[model samples]
Target chain A: MNKQTYFKKFKNIKYPISRRGLLISFMFYSFFHFSRKLYANGEIGGPFRDRFQSFRQTFRVEPNPEEAKRIINNIIKGRDKRNNLILLNAPDIAENGNVVPINFSVNCSMNGNDYPKVVHILVLDNPFPEIAKFFFSNQSGSADLAIRIRMRQSSEVVAIAEMADGTVGEDRFFVDVTIGACS
Target chain B: MARKNYRRRLKAPLTAKKGEVITIKTMAEHTMEPGVRRDPKTGLIYPRFIIDSVIVRYNGKQIFRSRWYSGVSENPYMSFKIKVEESGLLEIEWIDDYKQSTFKRSVINVLDNNGNEIFPIRLSEPSQSENLQ
Candidate 1:
């Protein structure tokens, strides 16, 4: 039971190496490795690769142009009643994009069908376009609001007012942001 | 876990004439994380934590409401207008993304043309007056 005898107990045991099994295992490993490389390089997985990843990882999500358009259209719908109902006031030049002061007022009298049901604020270049929405009731004497918001870049800020009588009014304002804010 | 204390500020007129429009301003102290900014040291994205909605109620009746997203700036400030007919309590509630809510309350005094303050509930009645007599 000495250490030297215990270490030499199985020193003479021998095993045969099979070249066929080694070749097969190597082939499987290489197949998987190469396939993964191909996938990582976008040589395979065409549809999925284009939409998701191509190895360049970015923390900030890119703003989708089509999605912004879709949201604008969804708010305006087909009935674009271009009128002087909604008056949006935003600074033409924002020194700090982190806090952009914006205010909007609806000319409606807040009576029966003239009052605004909802006023939606959208920034076209932000990753998430829809910013805020205001719901007003008859008790809300005036449909006016002032708020502070964040902007990723210089873009058109849109305010769409949907009235109770099935009418919609849209207003757009362009803001020049000196320094973009990350959202 | 919501460990930060959100400070709320509400400003409204103490008194108003009947059918007069009054302006109300509200502010809430919050970080308003947009869920996209990464930590510079660890490179980990900060989760979105923002005030989701704001509700303004007059005498327990909602008069104005708002829904907000991550685009709102930190320490959000909002101001709106409401018409008052009778004196009532005004409550403004700010609801956060984690379902945490904070509110502020203020009482408004509505007055009539004769400058008599309109009480929410009638104080004097014919039976009461007769009993007093």
Candidate 2:
């Protein structure tokens, strides 16, 4: 059976349908239409019928918890192990959110398969959850970095270290922002 | 289009011991616009303008790299560590979204035991002249 023969056979075959079957299918379609109208009118989904719209606009806001979770999940994939391998140092209170000084160091010797390949920084409440990513080589003695980042509000800063080996670790710190930055 | 002048700065220890880790700090002036702010009068959104990546190379070999998003504050400052095996030229490059790249370089002299500077290439050896047959 070649593809052309199969297509010719399908074209020759007829799907037999009775008048009663057509009438039943029309009724089913009408039922679906009515249900759709009810859903649009907020009667089907009850109080949370507008959740879909809210979900669509989830990435627009600064404090988007769902989007942050999605970004973390995408980064870590299935390897979600939290350990002390990564130490994230961030201020407990930042007077100005425009520049929050933060640093991170990985507890790994720069030996064969002990160093970190990439380290990710994420601000859970920022509009863009992923703040930065650092890539280190063996010549990079220490997997440590210090930088300044902007935060829209007080949020948990997460640092995830993906080691050269198949291991991953993360650390989180909460910082309170007295004045948030508009980004 | 007229481009704005961006100031770049790089600092590293001028001298260090062999097999020692040294810290390097780099700073670049950039607006780092997040593209979400609106103008007060025109209500126009500003386009995103930021440094996309930073690469650190020692003796022309890359040792460290970083990718920055708009979350990085204006005039970004970053510091990291690298192990020096020999004296070499260190370069830090900043690449922005506009495909413009700016780099700052510094030379470090690595000293071994007995306070002797180590050079990547032999300075005392002379090259042999090519012989034609």
Top TM-score model? 1
Instruction: Give per-residue CA lDDT, model 1, range B67-122, as digits (tens).
Output: 88878999899988999999999999899877888889999999899989998777
TM-score, one value per model: 0.78, 0.77
Clashing pairs in 1: none
Which CAPRI category fits model 1?
acceptable
Off by over 4 Å in 1: A1-59, B1-5, B123-133
Model 2 CAPRI rating: acceptable
Tell me the fnat of candidate 1.
0.82
Task: Give the Cα error of residue A63 in candidate 2, in Å.
Answer: 3.8
Per-prediction CA RMSD (Å):
12.3, 11.8
Q: What tens-digit string does per-residue lDDT give for candidate 1 at A100-175?
A: 9999999977887889898989888887777888999999999889999999899999999999988999899999
What i-RMS does each candidate reach, in Å?
4.2, 4.1
lDDT of 2 by residue, A63-142 (tens): 66886776676667798585689999999999999999999999988999999998989888887677888999999999
Report per-candidate DockQ: 0.38, 0.37
lDDT of model 2 at residue B21? 91
